[model samples]
Target: MSIFERMKQGATEAARKVEQTVEISKLKSQISTREKEIDRLYARTGKAVYDAYSRGDLSRSETEVMDYCEQLSDLHEDIKLIQEKITNIKLEKSCSACGKIVPVNARFCPDCGKKFPEDDEKPQESTVGEIRVLCAVCGTENDIGARYCVECGNELSPAAGDRSKPNDPAGDSIV
Candidate 1:
């Protein structure tokens, strides 16, 4: 190729790289804004739930709580996708256990003792609409799909439905 053609090609490649960088930056900013919104939604939902409980009106808050939870879940998934894009752009990897950024070639996370999954292994997708179950016996939170409490080894079935109220029938609130 001639010198002038080589110069033009180089300039075109540099312009494309700058354009790609700006797009990634925009995505990052959007993720940050979405995260802040999620935080605000969480606080608002918590207050709504609290206000309902204080008034002995748990049923009234259920719909709003569900909506907030769904929104938060969607935001989390979007953040994950954005992070994946950033990772691809930077050629980085994330620790599955702690979600910390790490080198793509690293075998384990430096911040957490999480081993990277092998190339042939695939991670499991999380179950959608998983409602967290608070253990009535020990006040420990467990997965919605968990059969037993991880903290106190208590059965989760009986305590699952009692999330909005006290476990004791005679009590008005959770102690």
Candidate 2:
């Protein structure tokens, strides 16, 4: 090929690459936006379900509740994929003791208590536990696992040591 033809071909190839890169960036931005939208939709759906349940309305006419349940399975799969992507994208920060992934500047790992660089903090997973507690003073609902109310800041009833149980013949203790 002539020198001029080679130059033209190189320019065209570079332009195509630039276009491709732009397209990829656009797609990434769109994905991020859609992810936010999905999150908002999930929150709204959860609220609707809660509201309907409070009203004792279990009818299937609620689109938000139905959509949420329908999306739950797909969302779970998407969550795993997102986690994998995050694990891949984040900078590697290994714990010196256990050789596990740690924050870039972690002061101490609850797992090993080994000081690691704690740079970025990711949201932790939520686990399910059943416990019921009613605040004594404010009569506010408190988490069974919580030591204090998040709203009223009232100290929760400490786990009784059966002191209250021994006094009564009935097995019921102060909860």
Against the true structure, candidate 1 has what lDDT? 0.70
- All candidates' TM-scores? 0.49, 0.34
* lDDT, residue 31, candidate 1: 99
| Residue pairs in collision within model 1 | none
Error of 2 at 142 (Å): 62
Tell me each candidate's RMSD, in Å, in order. Answer: 21.6, 23.0
Q: Where in model 2 is the C-alpha error above 4 Å?
A: 67-175
Model 2 over residues 1-175: C-alpha lDDT tens digits? 9999989977986786587566656655655765776787688787887777888884743876777767765655675565444443442345567655643333443234454443444443222254545567666444444444423445554442112333234534535
Worst 10 residues of 2 by lDDT: 159-168
Q: Candidate 2, overall lDDT?
A: 0.54
Model 1 ranges with Cα > 4 A deviation: 1-10, 95-175
Q: What's the true lDDT of residue 82 in model 1? A: 93
Tell me the number of clashing residue pairs for each predicted model: 0, 9
Q: What are the per-residue Cα lDDT tens digits for candidate 1 across 140-163?
A: 555554445544556665445345
